[model samples]
Target: MRAQIGDRLVLEGTHLGDARRVGIVIAVAHDDGSPPYEVRWLDTGRATLIFPGPEARIESQPPVADVSGPA
Candidate 1:
């Protein structure tokens, strides 16, 4: 999987009743947007480098709408 900074990393639970973990990609290790991202978890507010497993997926940031009036 590939990701950019500000993208969210979602790790789905592997077993029943397991909680999902979500984090923001604070840093990318590779220029091509590969794994080994530095993530700051939303739940615990802790940062760590992680090589995401199969259960992990990247959630790209939505495009920001233009609040300014149309030209």
Candidate 2:
């Protein structure tokens, strides 16, 4: 699967447990938006990241980032 930044990777009621987190795509993997993405999520005020495999289906896709905001 391919997804831009700000995509929410929810494991849902799958085997990964009922873990729910929302993180921004701080960084991309390759030139193309594929798997193994480094997602910086907010967990209890901590930013967690992981290189999830592309095989994992995305539950939802968030809107692309807006540079209009303060950088």
Candidate 3:
């Protein structure tokens, strides 16, 4: 798995009826965009280093630009 800063990590529940967890990639630990990313959980706003498992998936967002002014 690979990710960049600002990518969203979705962690599916292990068992039935478990609550899903969502986090954002705050920092990438490796140069190759590998695992062990520093993520901040949306639920609690807490940050931690995580090695994602099979239940985890990443949602990469496109770069944002200033669209307020005329093109």
Measured by lDDT, the strongest candidate is 1
Error of 3 at 70 (Å): 9.2
Q: Which 10 successive residues of model 1 have the least lDDT summed? A: 62-71
- What is the number of backbone collisions in each predicted candidate, taken in the order shown? 0, 0, 0
lDDT (0 to 1) per candidate? 0.97, 0.59, 0.96
Work out candidate 3's RMSD over C-alphas: 1.9
TM-score of each: 0.86, 0.51, 0.90
Ordered from best to worst TM-score, the candidate numbers read 3, 1, 2
Model 3 lDDT per residue over 1-71, tens place: 99999999999999999999999999999988899999999999999999999999999989999889986
Which pairs in model 1 have colliding backbones?
none
- Model 1's alpha-carbon lDDT is 0.97
What value of lDDT does candidate 2 attain over all alpha carbons? 0.59
Top-scoring candidate (TM-score): 3
